[model samples]
Target: MSYVNQSQTLNVTSEQKYQGLLEKVLLSTLIAMPCCVFLFINGTMLFTLRSKSVFRGTSRYILLYNLLFSDTVLLALSQFLYTLAASKIMLSYPVCGVFTMLSILTDEISPLTLVVMSLERYVAVCYPLRHATIITIRNTGVAIIVVWAFSVLNVFIRVVLLLDFPFSDLESLQMTDVCSDIDMILSPMSDIYDKAYTGFVFLSAGVAVISSYIGVMIAARSASTDKASARKARNTLLLHLVQLGLSLSSTINNPLLLAISKTVSRVVFARMQNFLYVCFFILPRCLSSLIYGLRDQTIRPILVYYLCCRLTLSPQPKLRPKIHGVN
Candidate 1:
């Protein structure tokens, strides 16, 4: 009877392990489907932006391209890192640093680019006569350059703060926990700086977007302003606020997940985390694509054409070439 009980206990343990594995696989699949869909949509949107001379030359479109490009890069890297964590793959500090740094670099670009785009829209709506001169192609290029330089500067600061950690004392560089940005916060200053920098960037960006929204609203009242243009710009700025909120929320998800875990069972926490990852990370990256592709009259049909790849559902018509009989 003792031996029989031991066998039974072993069977139960094996079953539990199998169940846990199955749950993780299911969650990963659920998360991956939406992420892949969003990635595809974002890719299609990027291609659509570059496919036309008009899109390439337009300042807003140029800013849109930069925004979508960074968002897509961050989304892909985030998904990859999520998968690694889901599979319990623990990476070495140096290795994880490479991954995290790339992720951070791209992650920072979206919010800044949105701020630039907001200003472009503001000028278009509030100062219509000067829009062409102020938002020239060269000016847009300079804005993009400045945005990237600023993001890189932030990364450099993080690296400098990271140097404060003593790497020589460790027995091994392999991380004790799953590779994540939180895990890489080896020193108090790193964490403090990260929080401080993130807070400041988001605060500044939020104020800028809100200010643009107000500017657009005030302009809407003027007799010189085009009512339709002002209305559209107002709505666009509102959506910019939403995008900024989503981006800001993503930066705080780790703490939110930790709080959530304290109140829920392990199983429940895992499920909630997977759901939140999709909402916070994957979905926001694709909003630029959706917002511009569907909302803009110029891009809606063209975006549809590229997304479908002429799969009979494309908006663009197919042409058949006629051949005269050689005989």
Candidate 2:
């Protein structure tokens, strides 16, 4: 009787552990699928856009391409982190710092790119005659380069400060056993600075996008010529508004998660957070690309062609047997 009870207890424990591992794997897979899909779709879109000279040379497409590139990198990073967490792999401080830096760099650049894109649209709609002069391909390229440089420099400064301030012991920093959101010990000032910087960037981008769209709507409304064109422009702006809202939600997601976490059990909280992450972060990344691919006249055909080719359903010419010696 004693032996049977011990065996039963051992089996139950083993089963619970197995269930936990299964849950982790399933959650990780769930988190990863959307990121993979986003990367594939955006990557194909990037290739298709770049392949055609007509699309490649346009300023709007250039901005869109950069946005896609940033999103792909961001999603790739998220996938990496989630996979690591699921596998119980911890990263050292330096590795974690690098991951954090690159993540921040991409995240910052995404909104900045959107801001530039919105401004580009605003200029095109409000001042159609001078749009070409104001937003040239060369200028767009330069702007993208500048945005990257700024992001890199911003991250570098934060990293330097983080290193300078001893966040626990060096051993702690190098320890790999941590959560997906790496918990780094920062000084009080550093913490404040980080929060302020994040808020400012988020707010600034949000305001710029909203204001640009408003300007575009007003310009479209007042324009006397090309009513149809103006209406189309308004529709495009509305789509952008949706995309912008989705992008900005990342900034707010953390707080919301924290609020909900307090009210839930550990397992429930984890599930809720995972659900939120997929819905808010991963889903939006794909939806943004879908919106652009579906709505943009220049990109729509190429996207459709790419999808058809991917499906192996593109029309093929029927083969004919040539008569021997007919020629």
Candidate 3:
């Protein structure tokens, strides 16, 4: 009776192993499909931004390029790690560190870049005369650089905290748990520091975006302000706030999943996690392309053209007569 009552399996069978593998494949495939689609869209958007001189020359467009570049890389890295975890692959400490670090580095850049973009819009509406001098190409490039440097500094602190772990004591560097940033939290201090850092970054970013929205709204009411331009700027700032909120939501994925796991069965938890991963992770990154590409009149046609595999979506321009009146 006692033997029959044992719930744990001491011996693993080949059939059970195959069943596990099959389930993993099924789950990963589901996530990978949408991830691939988003990646394609993001790639096309990135290429479209670079293809036009107008896009390349404009300050806001340059900032948009920086934002999309980070989002694209973050999405790709995340999917990679997700696939590895789903496949039950465990990476060594060093290998996983590099992957997660790159992931975090890119992940942090999105919100900060959004803040810069928001400020650019705010200035464009609030101080139209100075906008040209203020939001110059060189200044935008410097702002992009600063955003990256700040994110890198955050990642550097994380690396320092990781060193607190007694890695040398282990017989081998092979990690027993699935490789992830959460798994790498080997100490209480590390977890606390991560929470504090994430909270501060997101809170600061939220404030900056909201403040910009308010500034733009105030500028819209000014008598001298261009109503149409201010209205457009106001709308864009609102969308930036939404995008920042979505990015902020991603930082809570681990904590949220942990809370949900206790109340649900293992199977149910797994399903919920897969669903939430796509909703919280993939959709947020995909949003940037959709928000900018579909909404902006300037980008809409060219973006659609590239997205549809270079198929023309607009009326083709007629060629003018060549030299010597050649038609």
Task: Note the residue pairs that clash in candidate 1.
Answer: none
Tell me the number of clashing residue pairs for each predicted model: 0, 1, 0
**CA error at residue 167 for candidate 2, angstroms:** 5.3
Which portions of model 1 show Cα errors greater than 4 Å?
312-327
- At residue 291, candidate 1 shows an lDDT of 81
Candidate 2 lDDT, 1-327, residue by residue in tens? 999999999999999999988998888877677677678888888888888998778998898888888878888887787677667787777787778777778877777888888888777778888989999999999999998998888888787777887656555655646544326535665566667877887788778878887876677668453566666666766666677777767766767887987898988887887788787668767776788888787788879788677565558999889999886
Model 2 earns a TM-score of: 0.89
Q: Could you give the C-alpha RMSD of every candidate to the true structure, in order shown?
A: 3.0, 2.8, 4.6
> Candidate 3 on 1-327: residue-level lDDT in tens?
667545335334556778777887888888899889989999999999999999999999999999999999989998999888887799999999999999899999999999999999989999899999999999999999999999999889889989999999999999998888788788888899889989998889999989999988887888999999999999999999999999878888999899999999987898888888888778899899989989999999999888778775568899876798554
| Cα-based TM-score, every candidate | 0.93, 0.89, 0.90
Model 3 per-residue lDDT at 208: 93
Scored against the true structure, residue 64 in model 2 reaches a CA lDDT of 89
Query: Which whole-number lDDT from 0 to 100 does residue 144 have in model 1?
Result: 95
User: TM-score of the candidate numbered 1?
Assistant: 0.93
Ranking by TM-score: 1, 3, 2
- In the range 1-327, model 1's lDDT, one tens digit per residue, is 999999999999999999999988988998888889989999999999999999998898888889999999999999999999998998999999989889889999999988999999999999899999999999999999999999999888888888789999999998988888888788989988899999999999999999999999999999989999999899999998998888777887888998998999988997888888888888888777898789989999889888888566437767667778833
